[model samples]
Target: MDEIIRAAGALLGQSLRYPVDLGGSSRSTVLRCRTATGGSVIVKAFADDPEARRAYTGETAGLSLGLAGPELLAADIERRLLVMADLGDVPTLADLLLGTDPKAAERGLLEWARGLGRLAACSVQRRAEFAALWQHHGQGLPSWEDEPWQRQNVDAFLDLLTECGLTAPPGLADELTAVGTAGGERYPGFTPGDTCPDNNLITPEGLRLIDFEAAGYQSVFLTAAYCRMPFSSCWCVYQLPADLAQRIEECYQFEVVTQYPDLAEEELWQAGMAQAVVVWTVDTTLRLLRRALPQDGRMHRTRRPVPTRRQVLRHRWTSALQLTGYPAFTSTMRLLLSELAAGWDVPELPGYPAFRAGAGPEAVQTVNSRGPETAGG
Candidate 1:
């Protein structure tokens, strides 16, 4: 901590004190520090590792674009340290959803989608610029675009299926190859990377995106999947009322349609979105299946009132079945559902806490009857 603080202080020409450790993952250490001028700044120092260096590159490059996130105050590339303007103690979207107010949660969802879409639409033309910036800040490492992440995920999932005594559906590979093409390529857009519930601040001004550690250009459909799956990679996963979810999806769709009018086409939009969802579903299982198979645990380490791994997987499988045109992927999901999830004896995922039946005064209408919540232990 002292080492990072001294490096940051040197870059800013001032001493930073009273560090409040804002828990960062293995890749970095984040602190809210009091500057000499009585102001505050966020100081993040990356670990001396490739993963951390890459994250530093992405964040510095992303924020440098002035696309979104807090202002970059100072940086020391050699030290992999960043001093950014403090966003202060604002409540995040997670706070709203986990709280008792349904109205605030619903509002935040719609606005969050809209803000993200606008960010994507405006960034469509800056791909080359982003690539150049990435190259500049990156430690000569391959960018997300160069990495075959989806293919790797597919391969990993296939291996996982074999371990679980399951077989891939016959057409799954062909189907994934088909729809998966040109997701980001067709309608590429910039995003803060990890737009998870806890990563964004919902301030009085509006949604302030934080954590560009995963920042880069990718498929707009990937972002869309976040809404459809009700947050694809986040720990705040829970069932949103179908109607509300659709409204949130539409909110994003309308914004992006302004940039890529073709997204307005039902067939193209459906196909791309379905593909992104399929890949993400594979990703979710690949990430959680083995761990979940052993024992159910909270999705987050410290966040309270979070859903369990089994609940999230069950929800992922059930919702994935609603998607069509990926018959093999669909079958794969079914196999996981019957073979693995069945043995777990976990209940189907329930609605967002704010929208659950009989939620307090601010609750909206009941979730459009999705049958008796899957009964289980």
Candidate 2:
């Protein structure tokens, strides 16, 4: 223990106090530590993997907004160790969401978005550099689109539909393929590949975003893909109050409009749905099929699980059908709807009860009685 502390101190150029883990990504260990200099700091030590160095570089540059970038206290690039100021009062948006008051939660979420907007606007000049960083860190690598992560999701949804034995509206896969491909190209602003609620931080000053390992330059619509994961949950989207979902969309749109005036209303609406397909496709595969049938896990789009494919197509259909009625972006939405319907012929798979709370956010949304707006996501 002493030797480890000594090593940390030597690396930090100060005496080491104690270390407290702040759980973060699989690639880095985030810690709360005190330096002999009598100051607190947040330390991020990369795993054995060297890719983390590029991530750190991107995050450092991303923090140029000057609001929440922790001070770079020390770094040992060879060891993949990084130490910075620990912003003490900041709680992640996920933590803040536990608040009892719905209004407060909404406000907090909005604040988080505001901080993100600031980052997006200010970081515009670093666009090329940011893209380069993602490429270096594997953030820009095409998603394991055909990997088991995707197939599993498709399987889970199909299984759920089979269990319910609902006469599913047809053509799900075609719609998703079209939307996914098109949305990837058209989204407006930078897409933070990792926009899970946990990635947002709320400080007394407002919201500050952290964890830029997956931060990269992408079409703005792709950003919505990151944000729309909650809707894919059968539970949260269905169970949560409708007002909450509406507020979320409003806040998200407000931020986008504020950042890019040319952002057309149709574009905003299309981006939201387009991103929705991207997120749902990925999350379902990663979280669902992977869990039920581990051995079959090969990359998503690559290996096809005939059974699981039907289930995922079902969920995708549920989402697309719900969005079909909305007035905006009818043409594009129709395109997705038609594509989604094409998958109805897939044979149903049997396994896993329709997602319940334990199934994750998609299941959670389903329980809420929220509109397809929230549920289909």
Candidate 3:
């Protein structure tokens, strides 16, 4: 610890105070360091692991994109260290969603959507720049055209289900394959990859995204689907009502079109919806399968605290079921849901009831029943 502090201090050209370990994943070590002058900074040190190195490289690229995120103070790639401006102990969007105040979550979601739109817009204009980053980092962006990757995801899901003694629907693999194939060619844009609410911090400057470890170029709809499902395979599981989800989608679209007038709004929207349906369906299925069949070394191995596996699985199942109610891919998802429910122990998530899709304005009315104007104000 002292050696790390000294190295960071040397880079900052100043002495440092005690360093608090901010639990990072297995790939990196994050420290919140206080300077002798009382100011603080975050220093992230990547491990020698290949994935960790790639993440460090991608993070540097993301910070260089001039997006809404923490300011990079300095970086030493050889040493695998990044010193960044501390964004403070602000509550994350995830925290707000878990809090009692529904309005805060609404505001956070809107801000998150807007931020993501801005990111995509910027990346679209600087496609060449991101391409170079991808090459330099040795981490290529995900493409719907990548048949092998698509098939791998599908095969993994099927294998998981089969291992759990659960048989997937007859056409399930085919449906997923089709979606994956179509997704390859549509709405190609920048994706932050991991869009969990915890990655978005509500600083005084508004919502700023952090942790660009999984950041890369991909279909815009991939992220849109992530937002649509709120989050898949994450501890934070907050479901947005159908109407609210629509508004958030609109918010993202508005930002994209506003930034690049030459792009077609309807096309971008449709692509996002298409991509969202496929990704969410696949991700949700995998989550449920994992829950049903817990294997050795299958547990989540992150430093962040999370709910019990059972609770996490229940949240993923319920959220995915709610998404099936959406107008897009309704019949297919409905059939999938029925199949899963038939053999699974679907439990009620505490504090959240099972949400039916297409509930109209009433879906979000209860959360805003106090006053519509203040819901997201």
Worst 10 residues of 3 by lDDT: 368-377
Per-residue C-alpha lDDT of model 1 across residues 19-87, encoded as one tens digit per residue: 988777778888889999999998999888887888898898898888778999888788889899998
**Candidate 1 weakest lDDT stretch, 10 residues:** 368-377
Better of 1 and 3 by lDDT: 1
Ranking by TM-score: 1, 3, 2
How many residue-pair clashes does candidate 3 contain?
2
TM-score, every prediction: 0.93, 0.62, 0.76
Candidate 1: residue 136 lDDT (0-100): 79
Candidate 1 lDDT at 338 equals 89
Error of 2 at 221 (Å): 2.4
Top model number, lDDT: 1
Q: How accurate locally is residue 190 in candidate 2, as Cα lDDT from 0 to 100? A: 50
Please give, for residues 215-253, the per-residue lDDT of candidate 2 as tens digits: 455444544433343424322221234455455545665
| Candidate 3 lDDT tens digits, 145-186 | 232344677788778667656566667666666666334354
Off by over 4 Å in 2: 1-12, 50-69, 132-177, 180-188, 225-239, 292-320, 325-377
TM-score of 3: 0.76
At residue 170, what lDDT does model 3 achieve? 68
- Backbone Cα, N, C clashes tallied per candidate: 0, 62, 2
In candidate 2, how many Å is residue 363 off? 21
